[model samples]
Target: MVAEDDEINRMLTHHQLLDTGLVLEFAENGKVAVEKARANRYQLIMMDIQMPEMDGIYATKAIRLLPGYAEIPIIAMTANVFSQDRQVCLDAGINDHLPKPVRTEYLYDTLLKWLEK
Candidate 1:
């Protein structure tokens, strides 16, 4: 699953993830991401931090409160690459952080790290 507000970024991510053989779902903002996440089962969630309606940190926290989602890996995807930003994600219950524009190798490796167990 991916939560991203930018259409171009979402499309790019979709193309990059096509080879992973995972069924991808998308949300335009954090609010929709939370709703979709609650309604479906996803192996991993790639979340954009700057989305409107709700930010990724808040969305991750909200998702963490949902039944069966506490252990799910929610990785923050954002242009914010500073250590402080990464710590913020971790504090918000995100399992990992990925800097954008997302590199295919990193994205693939991150997904494998969380989903291939």
Candidate 2:
């Protein structure tokens, strides 16, 4: 599942990830992301950090408290490139961080790293 507020970024990620042959679902904001995550089982979640209504950090924390979600890999996708921002994602229980605009190769590699395991 991908939780992103921007349509263009979401579409781009969708296209980039299609080649992996994994079924994908999208959420337009962090609030929706948390709801979908709680109601469904996903192998991985691509979370946008700076979203409206909740933000990825809060969403991730909320999801972490849900049943069977503790082990799920939640990767943070954000424009904030600071070391402190990455640390915040880690503190929020995000498994990894991917900075935007996410490059196709890097995105693929990141997904592969989590999904393949």
Candidate 3:
């Protein structure tokens, strides 16, 4: 899966999973993320909310509309934890939301939990 923007967060997330042997791709913005996700088969997608050209919420919707990505899980990673933000992500068709500065344990748990569904 591709991580969109927030270099430090991406690095920490990637590093934390290095031992797991998961190949991660990075994109600087939602546009690139959308492109990459469509270019390959991703088990999941983790991305920041704020990005140039396109935002995570919008990208998530676009991805959902894509031919083969309707059921693919796209988890929103945002600093905003407001109920409205959560609702917005949900309304946009995102399966789940994770706050920024994501902890390794939570990431692993969320992925496992969602993948099991």
Candidate 4:
């Protein structure tokens, strides 16, 4: 699943993932992301750190507390390249972190890393 507030980001990621033979769903904000994660199981979750209503960290924390989501890999995606922000994401239950503008190869690599492990 992809959770992003940016229309272009969500659309691009969804299309890229879809074309790669990976089924995907999108949420416009953290609120919607929580709902989607609770309702379905995803192979991976790509989270935008800065988002409306509930930010990615909070959403990830909440998702981790939800039943059956304990082991799902949640990777943080953000334009903020600061080390502090990246560390905070890891502290908030993100299994990994990816800086945006995500390259196609890197995105696929992140997916493969989690699934392969």
lDDT of each: 0.92, 0.93, 0.81, 0.89
> If scored against the real structure, what TM-score would every candidate get?
0.97, 0.97, 0.92, 0.94
Q: Positional deviation of 66 in candidate 4, in angstroms?
A: 0.8
lDDT of 1 by residue, 1-117 (tens): 899999999999999988768899999999999999889988889999999999999999999999899999999999999999999999999998999989999988998898976
lDDT, candidate 2, equals 0.93
**Which residue pairs clash in candidate 3?**
none
Q: Give candidate 1's error at residue 23 in angstroms.
A: 0.3
Which digits, one per residue and each the tens of the lDDT, describe model 3 over residues 18-84? 8876778887888888888778878778867888799988888877877788888888888988999
Which portions of model 3 miss their true places by more than 4 Å? none
Worst 10 residues of 2 by lDDT: 13-22
* N/CA/C clash count, model 4: 0
Worst 10 residues of 1 by lDDT: 108-117
Instruction: For candidate 1, give the lDDT of residue 6.
Output: 98
Candidate 4 — what's its lDDT?
0.89
Error of 2 at 57 (Å): 0.4
**lDDT, residue 74, candidate 1:** 94
lDDT of 1 at 42: 84
lDDT of 2 by residue, 12-87 (tens): 9988978778899999999999899889999999999999998999999999999999989999999998999999
Per-candidate alpha-carbon RMSD to the true structure: 0.7, 0.7, 1.3, 1.0
